[model samples]
Target chain A: MIFIKILSILVMLFYALGSAGVFWGIPAERYKILVLGKFFTWTGFALHTLLIISIILLNGADDLSRGYFMQLLAWCILLAYFIGWRLLKSGFLSLTASPLALLLFILALKVDKVQIEMPGTLKELFIALHIGPMYTSLGLLTLAFGAALLFLHMDRKIKSKTRLTEFDRGLPALGTYDRINHLAVVFGFPLYTLGIAAGFIWAPLTWGREGGILGSWDPKEIFSVFVWFLYASTFYLRILRGWRGRKAALLILFIFGISAFSLLGVNLFMPTHHSFGSLATFTA
Target chain B: MNKHICLVGLNHRTAGVEIREAFALADAGLLENGLLPVGAHLKKDLPIKEALVLSTCNRVEILLAGREEKLEELAIRSWAAARNRQPEELAPFVYVHNDAEAVKHLFAVASSLDSMVLGEPQILGQIKDAYKDALRAGSTRFILNALLHRAFFVAKRVRSETGVASSAVSVSYAAVELAKRIFGDMPSCKAMLIGAGEMAELAATHLMNAGIKSILVANRTHERALELASRYHGLAVPFADLFAQLPEVDIVISSTGAPEAVIRAKDMAGVMRRRRNRPMFFIDIAVPRDVDPDVNTLDNIYLYDIDDLKEVVEENLTQRREEAVKALAIVEEETLNFCKWLESTELQPTIVDLIRRSEAIVREEWTRTSKRLRLSEKDTRALELMLGAIVKKINHDPINFLKNRFEEEKDGQYAGLLRLVFNLDKKELCPRRTREHGSEEAPPPLGPPDGGMIPPRRTPEPAAAFFNRIKEGSK
Candidate 1:
């Protein structure tokens, strides 16, 4: 447990340093600092991977703690960032990924651990299918949100005909941001559907047919379905209608907002089966 | 003796373009298959060992290596004579640097520090071409070959270690930079030339060289548009259909001679819808602005008139000036290093004399002793091996001292001291040959009648090559 704590702190330090490097590098226009930032991010990623493996080894595969889930979410976000960085050949994503990863890791340290209980081995398989794709898709959605925000900012700067700031100069072309948004939705929507299908299948078996297909009219399940519909419509509009640029970027931002509410607010504030523990215990 | 490296020239700062053109050696056909005219003329009257002539539109310089006393005078006379002018007429505009200064000047010139535009890259290629001409004419020998190679190395060092040439200093280049920021990938973007003006044509050339996919030319005069389009292998569109073609190009350069705005916000709104809101860049370079200022308010359109481009160019030029300061420091550091190597070459003749004297003494003693002993062939071989080892061992400390002490003392003082201590100046064991035959094999000297007892004199290699061999052997 102490070793896990130490490793988590080291991961946090590296991520914080990487964020600082990106913030300083872009404005200064020094390429070496940017490369150093990338090196730090990769180092933090390696240590974070080790931390996750150790947590799994100590607590078993069924340890579905809220803190562990946050760590995994941060890891998946970085994974999505690395993939986008390689595919698009852009370093601007680090401006978002590094600081966000550090924030999530710090949040993971503050949140209480709450392990979920499972009755059968088949349910464990279903949980993996549900959690894995769901968090990965959420990670990609987070990146899409960042790309959309940058696109709008750059779009406004160009339209305003103002002198570009150093941060604006460091941004990739507006088309590059649109491409990232396109890639995220194209891949994230399908994986999100798979995760929803797995959850729907697991619900009836776990609740003993008392609550029907969805297991109950819980806020978590209702909001999840709503978020899925929003994503599906975004994907459809992007592909069939040839929607691009400002409209596509705006829609992606809206979908990401509702998805964030479903993932966090529905589980915490509302009455839902996905709540980690009792409200009294969570607040304490 | 140290070879005197000298440079005499007139550049844009020292002479006007009329004088520079009159003194240009390229017009004299120096690049043809013959000795350089100035070099051939100097060889007839002076002791010039090596010469190279560099002639460009901005400057004409002659780099020579010979005796220091009259080398500059002789080089100026020959240079002026080749151009059918008197030496006195061109002397006032000329500047001369000998030895260390000459090396520094050449390095700075090759690094583009001395260019008209501070960090322009064309000067290095011009110097390289001049060096190649000298090599073809067989006018450059030992000293010049090393100096030119070192100058090239210094130029590369300055370029890579500094940001001197990393920014755009011209209006066309600034436009290209802005376009890159908008489109990211230039090869996928198309460009439209709205006029056949020189500025627009220059921007079109830069865009094509940047690998823009295709170009469309539109002008008020169809014949002029056709002529310009044929040069770039692009299509010529009629001026009436300019709005229809505006949506197809990602970049538009407008310099039409119009009193009013050529592209308006209302027309661009329909074009933006047709382009699906893809980004479009407009570069307006006309006295009366060609692009409407209101068009810049549209969502995906970026417009820059001539004043904006001039502002970008000014910012970049200021950055280049800062970078050039760093580059000049590198040139200074490397100049000092090359001068140290030049100083080390003066020690070569002393080292050669020391070795030859030691070998001569060893051979003289061995011949007299062997004749009285009447030794067999195997014994003779053994004695010869022992004597050769003795000569090498005896000369080792003195040679080491001379090589190491030259770096600490003033030039050639340690060499002179060693010559005095070793009694190397008492007799001239070997007669000095003219520098032109300095590398040829020396004739056999008078030794014992046995003939093979004394070894043949070693052929002299250039000092730089000889020092490199010694360094490699030590390593």
Candidate 2:
């Protein structure tokens, strides 16, 4: 429990430092230490997942229906942290991913940790198919964001064409980062497409036939497709036409911004059952 | 002591490409014939004591390690003879140092601080190669073994902790990267490697590796070009035919050892006509580059020399300055640790001597007392325990203090007092003074300079010692 509290505090402080632009004159060992610290945090996340499951078992199956959103988001965040941990270990994505995971964990903590028991079979399957892919997509996009930031930093440093500061050594090469960002989009697309498909399939059962298909055309779903289009365009333009370096870097960044909007943004603005309580306005 | 290091010879720095080539020994073939003179001189006149010879196009440095008195010019005279150069001719340019200064020189050399171009890491690799060659030649002696290992440690500290090895440190490599942008893939292009200087090879090697198809080695001396060209498997084009070679070459990486720009604007303007509409990349890695400055203005040609490439290298270096500061802290930490280890070596003998003397005194006194006063077995056992505790208490501080003395050589006077009290044998505790006739007339060249380690300065508090007297100033 103490370790869990410490990790939460560390994650908050680390993100706050990043947001404040406090990075400078960092040692070679700095990220090596961060990687080790992040590994311990994943362990705490596992323990937290165990605690939530115990609470869900104590509650009856009927409660699983009403309170399942919190449970879905929690498991999604936990999976996000685990995969983020792997990416950081590979040195593909680093300090940037931690902040996003930290924010999601905080969001989970805000929601009820009192998880309810299992739902009806059809409902459970639908929930798993829809929520699991969305979380997986979120994690991949987080990795893309990390790569994109490094690419921007490296590009800025090169364009300035002045003396490199300590920051240059801390950065992966511009070409290397650009390639990683491209990879994220390549990997994230299929998973997100499947999630959208699953959401549509589960749509008829929850909202019912013609009405259900109408709910499936909710703004969140529309924007998800829009994001998919943006990323697919980036991949096509880059691979087929050799649109690389800075031009390619800027495009990926544009795609990442659209993705964040669809993940946290559409959730805030769009209406229908998929919307958060604060953002429920269905005009059509 | 065997702490001093002596280095003498010519490099790309002190002498031009001509002198470097004249003294260059590129093979073991030269070691037998050219180095024979050195062996004979060592046998007839003076022993080298300990020496290692490093000959590369950039520089030829002969590092000699020995007692300061034994490692003088006379010891290094044969090393000069190996190059077939007069002792005095090389002596004026030769630099010598002892102990700490010597270690600093080795560190600087390996870390590229002493390079013609700062932060070029090629020198460290060259030094390592030289050490290996020395071992193979059986030229390494006792002092050299220690110095070589210490040199590597110092280099590791400098590189890991300093910005010495970070960023685009080498101008030549920077030239190539920038050229890559201008030419894209250069496999379809032709490159001319001007000058056969060692530094030129580094730049040319990088360019050739980057997919430049035909690499032609051109120089003032045809023989030097022939020799160098054969090694890189490039064709040796004569200096007079430079204009002819210019027509076909797309990229010209010149590190010609000329003292001035050999390729004038008139020549470049003439060559540009032949280049047609093709984009030609000319990197003048040479200090006084072969290509003229105005050649950069020529259409369809990008000309960058040492001065221009340094600007890019400097820019990248500036970005690494923060990392450099962090590295310096690491260096300081490592230096202190090494200094501690050095002092510990000094302390070990003193500590061992003190323990031996203390135990002997205890044993002698205990036997005399037990014979006369102790009658019962229980009394004898009690007496032995009492004597042992007394010895332990008495011996504790002095031994511990000697070990602590390594922390800035504190209580410099305490060592003598402890030795006197314990009656520790002087011969065993201190370094045995040896007759250093290993080489004569080669006493360490002591130059008058105040370049010793800077003692930690005291920024006096305005309160003037807070609660204590300002003894020296008041007096």
Candidate 3:
């Protein structure tokens, strides 16, 4: 576990350096820095993988708590960046996603202060199915959010008539970034829908429908729906109303903010099965 | 004899177009005839070994490699005689580069670092063409072969590794680039050329290259429109059918030499209504302004005038200048590398002579041992192979050391000492045997050496304006 913690910190530092190096003025140094960053990141990823495998082997799936699941979210985000870096041929995507992954890894290290137990029935394949799609979609949406932020930054630079810096030049084409944003939304929204459906299906099985399958209108569940609607509206506005460019970037930015709030904030304040009993428990 | 490289040239900065044009060779015959007249005269009157003449619209340069110590006067005199002018008349405009400076100048020129429009890529192609002419005329050999090939490589490196040429500097290119931002990839969009003028044709060329699906040429003269349409592989619509084609095409590039507006705001409102409000890009490049400024106010209609494009061009030029700083660094790095290689070549004669002497001695020793041992033919062959391997391994370190370092005056003295100690004949040290023996070994191919110091290969796409790139990114 200490090894894993050390590796995660190293990953954070490397990712920071890599992101910074992409904007380096000298082309030669920029290449060297980018390569070094990748080397550290890959090494850290290996250590992280070993840590996860060891945890799973020692504790088994039942001991795979929300904290571990959050660590898995961090791993998934790194994996997505590696995949995106290959497919898009842009280092900027990795630069954008790395900090988010670092944040998740740090969160994973933090002690889970709140602990309320979930029903034993909730530990089935349905739970894994629900968590998998939810976290993966979250990772995908995070990528879209990263691209949207870059779009906004570049757009702002152009609008304000500020001279574009070397950092701005390193970003992918606005259209390419926008398409990446659209693609992440297109792929994530459906998976998120699946996760929500799986949550509803498991709700009845676990809770026995005594207080209603939705757990008596849980606040976390309501906010999750709110988060879903925000992202869903991005597609609706994009496909139907032809909202694109800056307008679409703005909408995705908002959706990402709300999704982050729903995922982290709701978990902290509201008691629900969606938190897997790791977050704060509210008493009426 | 030490062959010195020199460049005597005049560009837009050093000379006016009139002066440059007077010295420039405007015909392919001048190249094939074994000269630009100046090159031929230099070959005849001076100790010139090889020469290449790079003549573009903006400049005329005579790049020479030879034993001539006083090449500037010879080059200037020949240039003046060829142009039927006095040597003193052209002396003020001509500038000279010697040896390393000459190599640096060639690298800069080939990389477009020395171009009037800082990072335009056409200069590299022009350099390539000149090199090809020199090669065809049998005027480029040994030193030039290495230098010219390195120049092309440097150009390729500068282009791929820097953003120098990644922005449009011309108004026509800016218009097309802006159009791309409005309508992504414009390949499926129909574009109408509103006039058959030069600016319109240039814009149409840029648009066509950007992959517009179709083009419609419209002019007051039906015949002129037909001529322009055929040239661009587009349909020529009659002037009367302007409104009919206007509603169909998504992009309108109007450069008609009109005194008044060719497209009014009222006309665009109806066109927008008829087309169901699909986005339209109007590039008004005409001076008196072919499209009314008010059309820009209409919903779904984006109108950019000549001045707007000029502003884009200016911004792009600014960006290109920023990129050129990186590009010139690449050029300087490549220039140093080429100079190192040239310096290494100074050690080549000694290296070649040393290897030959070693090979002869090894053969003699092998024969003596074989005869004494009375070894079988197969055993003797094995021994010969082993000895050959030993010789290669022995030479590898010295060869690599000399090739990698920029050999200085001390290194040259070391080379001379080695030759003298080995009792090597100066005749055996003559590396230019191809010239002496009249052997026709082809010059090195005009590109980067295989597996050299260049970074990994990247597919070089045509340079696009940075504004369009950002605009598309914002999308």
Best by TM-score: 1
Question: What tens digits encode model 2's per-residue C-alpha lDDT throughout A163-214?
Answer: 4444454444444455555666666666677777876675554445575544
- The runs of at least 3 residues in candidate 3 whose Cα sits more than 4 Å from the true structure, single-residue gaps closed, are A1-54, A82-89, A111-129, A154-173, A213-215, A276-284, B26-46, B76-92, B181-184, B192-198, B216-282, B286-303, B322-326, B374-417, B426-475
Mark the regions of model 2 whose C-alpha exceeds 4 Å error after superposition.
Answer: A1-96, A109-121, A152-166, A173-175, A209-212, A215-217, A228-251, A278-284, B1-91, B129-144, B167-172, B175-344, B354-394, B403-475
**What is the per-residue lDDT of model 3 for residues A1-284, given as tens digits with 9 covering 90 to 100?**
66545655665566555445544512444656766656656565666777678777766665455566666777887787777677556666666565666666666656323343344564556656677788778777777776777666755554333445555555565565577677877888888888887777766665666666555787777877887788788777766665555777788888878877776666655676555354422110
* Candidate 1 off by > 4 Å: A1-6, A28-33, A53-69, A87-91, A109-113, A117-129, A142-174, A200-284, B1-3, B29-47, B66-70, B344-404, B415-475
Report the C-alpha lDDT of model 1 over B55-126, residue by residue, as the tens digit. 989989989876445588877887887788999999999999988888889888999888888788998898
Least accurate stretch of 10 residues (summed lDDT) in model 3 chain B? B455-464
True contacts kept of 1: 0.38
- CAPRI-style quality class for the chain A–B interface of candidate 1: acceptable
If ranked by TM-score, best first, what sequence of candidates would result?
Answer: 1, 3, 2
lDDT to native, each model:
0.78, 0.58, 0.70
Q: Write the per-residue lDDT of candidate 3 for residues B390-412, one digit (tens) a residue.
A: 88888787666655542444234
Ranking by lDDT: 1, 3, 2
